[model samples]
Target: MPIYSSDSDSYDVSSSSTRLFQRERPLHSILGGGRVADVLLWRKKNVSAAILLGLTVIWCLFEVFEYQFLTLLCHIAITVLLFIFIWTNGASLLNRSPPKIPEIILSASAFKQVAVTFHAELNRSLIVLYDIACGKDLTLFLLAIASLWILSVVGTYFSSLNLMYLGFVAIGTIPALYERYEHEVDYLAGKSNRDLRKLYKKFDSKVLNKIPRGPIKQKKSK
Candidate 1:
């Protein structure tokens, strides 16, 4: 009974496109937007950032007030309650018709999936190590290893609570700081890369290339 005009269709399309564009505005505007958001997915990343900040504050309070046992007790209670809830009412609370899956089959499938994921990740890690072994991006690889080693050493000197507090604070603050001063950070990063490359080139020319080659023992004739 009703006829739609071309103009009306075009208007509807344009309005929808405009709404989508507005919706797609970078999440980094509110938090760290780019690669960080991409890796975690934006909403989850924001929630994680919020949790990190909140926990950091709570950790500081606990440390300052010397309520370490209280923190442990709270964590244990929460864990126990979570497990009880999940075991008891979780199925009903899901509000879906009961799954037809056999429990053993489901568990086996889950284990298989976990094994596949573990294998994939192990292979990926080995590939990264192999690349590092081959001296690809050697400087960056060494820097990452050095950073991890330094963190391990530093962590040993701090109490678990203090280390956790620092970890959460760093997680929450660093991304936000980088997001706020992204252009400056990028500029500095670019400059550092250039300097590093120059240094690497100089080292290669003056030192690495000058190393005497080891004598190659030829294979004996059969």
Candidate 2:
């Protein structure tokens, strides 16, 4: 449809005109991305930190010989720590890379493999850190054996019996110990995977940057 304008400059009052009108109009509606992931991430860290703090306090009490509540507090503390560490690191490590077309086209197995790989690496890193820190506690088991030996040789055979018994005792701590080990492994895995994911995200051409939703125009400084 041809529309005539009497003015010197003619504007095509069609699709182009509608576009110009849209360009001039300001957005009254709010724009936002979903915060579900971000909120969950924050909760992951905060809850983990809170758990760790509480566990530390309980362990301190346990060390002070608070026998009345030692076993309960100690086990609970370790359990909570275990869960928190796994969650905090897991959430961070699991990167949402833009889907790869070939992989999706060829097989879903490729996507499954990607998830497995990310999890494996994160778990490995967490274990390494856990092993290093808990090593000292593990050493206590060895030291207990040594102390028991010296007691048997120098003192009466039964005099240091209780202390010697504790040498074999930390065997009870093994599960909690391993739990810590696993926690650290997860952390390490996540950290390493996250770094690798970041590198991949930066280099991958398919992952395009989103543009601002508005007309582009050159602005001059006043």
Candidate 3:
């Protein structure tokens, strides 16, 4: 003979419900899970979509409402007002000791630091060029340069809005599609690589190898 309490029945029901939810978790993940949620919330690559959306809105406003002069006026007014407010009340708001600019931000030292950084980066770039010219990455380096030249020329012909749309579409869809069909994509890419390598070898032998070479420089006695 057993006495069954209502609370025990409720506890059993709750436990069963929890187990059911746990079972559905994987189904939820298979459909569209946390990664999709994060993308919808504009994480990482979705940020570009968000920016493109913002630009699209601005372009619409400019085109539809003729907001050019109004936009300029609003910008100027807001900047002036903010500047005045800061100039007038900044001291009281800060209420701290003398607010001198940091030594790093000061004119001469900052300029020197910038100059040094610029020269360091310039030297690094020269070293990279030398390595590319001397090493096996020369073909990749030339391809990159040619790609940049083509991109610049294409960009000059296309309007900013067109380029933005292209970027938005590519950034939004390409990664997700690639992730979804990665194996198939890889298979296709491997096939393409084989074909390209064959073509490259044929071209090098027939066309490039026959190009006239410059006279080799003989080393002079020191």
Total backbone clashes of candidate 2, pairs 3 or more residues apart or in separate chains = 13
Higher TM-score: candidate 1 or 3?
1
- Residues 129-217, model 1: lDDT tens digits: 78876777788687778888998999889988888777767766675566555445544454456577878899999999999999999
lDDT tens digits, residue span 17-51, model 2: 33211233322111112232222223345654454
RMSD of each: 14.7, 29.7, 17.8
Best by TM-score: 1
Model 2 weakest lDDT span, ten residues long: 25-34
Whole-model lDDT values for every prediction: 0.64, 0.48, 0.60
lDDT of 3 by residue, 42-160 (tens): 44565657765776776666555657757767987999788766766776677844344467766797698779867986998798677776756644566568888998999998876
Better of 1 and 2 by lDDT: 1
Better of 2 and 3 by TM-score: 3
Query: How many clashes in candidate 1?
Result: 1
Give me the runs in candidate 3 sitting further than 4 Å from their true place.
Answer: 1-52, 62-135, 214-222
TM agreement with the true structure for every prediction: 0.50, 0.17, 0.44
Ranking by TM-score: 1, 3, 2
> What is the Cα-based TM-score of model 3?
0.44
